[model samples]
Target: MAILSALRLTRAPGAAFVVMGLYWGVFAAHVPVFRDRLGVDDALFGTLLLGSSLGLLSTMWLAPKFDQGLGRAALPTAAALLALAWIAPSLAVAPMAFALGMVGVGMASGLLDVVMNARVSQIEARSGRSLMNANHGLFSLAYGLAALASGVTREAGLPMIAVFGGVGLLALGLMPLLSRAPAPAVAPEEGGAVRLPLWPVMLCGIVVMIAFLSEATVESWSALHIERTLGGGAAQGALGPALLGVTMTLGRFGGQGLAERLSETAVIRVAALVSATGAAIAATAPGPMVAYLGFAVTGLGISVIGPMGLALAGRMVAPHQRSQAIARVAVIAFCAFLIAPVLMGGLSEAFGLRAAFGAVAVLLLMILPPVLALRRRAAAPLAVPA
Candidate 1:
């Protein structure tokens, strides 16, 4: 019920999340095709994918400005732009063109991601509700559905353009839902940028970054792992991400209540361990069914980490700096998207997807140190310099 209430309260931002989920879901399910189209190996495909980070990195400063300048329209505007930008990758036939297309995708995705998360923080502060998990749950739900559908279409031999273009149209149609103005909150200063807390933000950002890297691992490579490594068909490969989406939805929706009962750090600590175990299982799995079980476990554990990190960062800052703090953490964490393609690509190319996933298991453990640091500072007053 709280999840439903939170989703209702943050409908506009939730819609933005859903749109992102749909686009990414479709993209994730179709990675093999995209790579095949360019006729490149995993290593080069990963490098080319890194180009999107250039676009994402550029938004670190621009996102805060967009929040201040556009006010309520910021999230929807970014979503609309993303609708147009996501179509480019389907059109790209060469490695160079694909790389450039990813830049466009990254730019649009970065802008929307920052604005929507910041908006959710703004609403949470005003409504005094734990909304992040619920909103993210909505995204996961949409992502699963989209991935399932994309798999069906791919198996039917549908054109990439038709699939991506249809997703864009769906995103465009959701613009009205995402267009609502924000709940009243302290607006950032119009003329100058506010300084965000460096150390605390970085600590939380790293946790989020690791979580996202693990997430990107599955999103970008899980299908290939299932189909190639486990000898699954196209539909079975799609189920890899689809299962993650489903479990994440359950985990995040459940997290709304879990956050109320437990400390955010505690939840994240246990979550990290759980997710690590799941990744390990996935890495060692010999069959698609075993892999599915591993992925399901990973999704449930990882679902709450990023949301909790952002929620913690928001709590640590002043109201006016919430957007900036979210933006900064997002900038740092989103670098995982950049790192994932190359890291996972190289690992899978050399050692295989199993080793690459094993590395994800190791990476999940890295969240524990930051969890300890955040707990130590939990009682400290907000002490960041202006």
Candidate 2:
């Protein structure tokens, strides 16, 4: 009931989240197929994924300007671009071409991500309700469904074009739902530099960054881990990421109500420990069933961490500064996505995928110190300008 109500409040931005999930979910499930077609090892493939850093750069420099210029149209426009951009990699057989295609996908995804998250923060401020968890929960649901569907498609021996085309068209169909009322204008940076609580923002960003890093590592590699490492079939391999998505859906939705009742810092602390244990289990799992169990546990615990971190960042700033603060956090958080594929690849190449996953467990545990710092800072009263 609480999640349903939060979804009602955030339906517009939630549509963008859903669209983003559909693309990435399908892509993640198809990673094995894509890699085989390119005929490159994990290391080279990881290097190719570095192309997304270009998109990260664009998001850092242009997303704010793009958001300001397009206002209400930004979300739909970015959605359409993503739908179109995803077509490139689906068709590319060569490594270089595929890398370039990822650039388009990454840029479009980052722009949409920043705009939608900012919009949600705005809605949270206006409605005085916790909505990010529910919105992100919808993303997980869409991602899980798409991964399951893509797995079936792969088992059917369908071409990448077919799977990607279906997802692209689905994204285009959802564009109208993303349209919404214009946001209230924010002061231009030149108007005056509002003194930001930089330390708190950085702390929250680190939390979000770690959460996404774990997510990206799992999404990009879990399928391969199940198939090659545990001898799972295509459908079984897809279940790895699918289970993560499904459990995350539950966690995020549950976290919606929990956020209102619990201390966000305490929630982060507990979630990190829970997720680390799950990752450790997955790292040492002997079979597909056990790996699924691990992924499920990891998903449930990690789901709320990123949303809680973003919510913390928003609360630490004033209304006019909300967008800027969230954007900063997002920029930092997105570094995880940029680094995850390459880092996981390098780690998997050097050690086995199991060890790579074990490293993720360690990374999850490392976020505690930052959470401690954020807890102290969050205790301080904010100095909002009139």
Candidate 3:
């Protein structure tokens, strides 16, 4: 019965990931509409998107408290907030209103991100399993399906509000699943939580930021690149992100199987190189089909970085410090979301979109040295916790 309970509980985190992915997938599909709705150019829209990150940053400080205070309740509550907040951006008519709506979305997304990841870490610790990749795979699958569906819906002439409203309702429907899951057990070592070691944690945070920045660049900007730069139609442009999502889903499931055979360092190093190569291909792709292939390659290569990084962070800390440790790393990593859109928008505005993509390739390659350093240090005898 205990084993069965564990099996059942594991589904909660994956479901949460899917719900969040659905929101993002729909958002990605509707970007052109969003831009037109607010009457902003790419650069201005990027700046507006920064408001969500600001809101995320502001609310991140509360993550640990939520984890400590709410326990299992935290995930559902944050998810519910995310569901409601997702509608705000869909309702906005002006720039300020849109920005304000993004703030709410960011706050909710940030909270949900931290809590759900923490729950997954706890689940892995208890189950002695590598579940991160699989859970994230579910996210990518949902994202891909949602993006494709949204494209069809838009082509069918459904209003954005109606589309987004359905997503919000789906999230509400998933809330009950969380209630059925067991709460994570706090271990003895974690009873009195102490300060997590700053040096390694900071290093891990940097790695996560680089990974997230690379991934977000493609996910957020690829559609616009396909449509504006490559002259793809709406359905074809939507295919860019959708294809990325599909490949990422496959890659993460592959990572789940590989985790036991390979070290996190090994996986990340190879993944980064592959991601850089994919970025380069994307930067030079002359046509939409070629660009789609590039994005798909990029997705497959970067798929494991975020989940693996979070899993590594979880392993480094005491069981009790899981939520707080993951939160700290996430706060730093999520800043990529804050920076990537604006940076890419400015770069795309100044140089071409191709140039902007080239910069992403450079950023991905930069992870190699850090990954090597981490592997070397991890090989040494541990005097500190992580």
Candidate 4:
């Protein structure tokens, strides 16, 4: 029964990841339209991404509380369903209305992330193995397929809204499946009640945030950097994101095997070093091809960090206390992700895209120590012989 439950819960996150990919696959081309619809400049547009993060943070805070009465299914359902449900408002021609719609979408996504991830932790506990990386990899793959779909659509000059809205509508099909899945968590937990060592998890949170920020920065800004700094054409520029996504998916797919062969601590340390170097190289690459190579290298280096870190966090603490701990770490990670797009956009606007990626490279370097600590924390306390 737990195995079946794990499979069902696992499917929810993978499906959600793929659907988000589908939406963006065709919708990114509408960036200018979304900008125009929001009545904002590039900087503000970047800042606006915060709405989603904020929505995510807020929902993370509330999901556990809501789950108290609504049961485990509550958070994921809220998270999964609303991302697509509010599209009607998002499609409105007005900027304020569109922004409002984005807020709804962001909040829904954030709530869903909190719930789904919490469920992921639960699923891992029940299954007694590592499944986080593969699940997240599916998310990355969905993101790639979505972006590729968008590129093909753009070449046809289709209405971006039509493509996105169609994708949004298709998300409706997922709701029924999600509704049938068993609730993994019963309630939002009080940080006050958690007995886990906050310092260790807190440290893990910082590293996770840095990794997330690196990923978010590349996801949001790599293509722009390639185009503006490396002189890529429209197609090349567009391909930059797809390249990053594909590389990341491939890296993550391979990460599980690598994790089995090494300690998570050692893997994280090496991966962080490689990622930081890749970021630097990408920032300075003389042309697009080099930049793409840099992006792929960075992807491979960082791919394992996310899943390994999250799994360590889950195993480090007691089962009853895991959700709040995970949430604490997740909130910190979301803050980094939330800030990434805005920060990159502002840096790009003020200096150039190259400078922005250089900043991400620097942040990626900071993750190594904490990841090592998290790994040590997860290892068994050696039993002394009587």
Q: Using TM-score, give the best candidate's number.
A: 2
lDDT of 3 by residue, 136-158 (tens): 78888899888888888878879
Which tens-of-lDDT digit does each residue in 163-277 have in candidate 4?
7666766676776655554575544445453356767778878877888888877776665576567887555655666766777787787777887798767778898999899
Q: What lDDT is obtained when candidate 2 is compared to the true structure?
A: 0.87
Which ten residues in a row are the worst by lDDT in model 1?
A: 180-189
User: lDDT tens digits, residues 1-386, model 1?
Assistant: 66777888988889999999999899889988888889998899889989778888887667767777877788888998888887777898989988898899888888887788778877876887767788889999999999989999999999989998898888778888888848325553497766777888899999999999999898889999999899999889998999999999999999888888998899999999999999999999999999999999999999999988987887788877776777678778988988999999999899999999999999999999988998877668877566
TM-score of each: 0.92, 0.94, 0.91, 0.84
Ranking the candidates on lDDT from highest down gives: 1, 2, 3, 4
Candidate 2 lDDT tens digits, 275-338: 9999999999999999999999999889999988887887778877876787788778888977
- Superior by lDDT: candidate 1 or candidate 3: 1
User: Which stretches in model 4 have alpha-carbon errors above 4 Å?
Assistant: 1-9, 24-41, 65-80, 83-99, 185-194, 318-320, 372-386
RMSD of each candidate? Answer: 2.4, 2.1, 3.0, 4.2
lDDT of 3: 0.82
CA lDDT of every candidate: 0.87, 0.87, 0.82, 0.68
Q: How many residue pairs clash in each candidate?
A: 0, 0, 0, 5
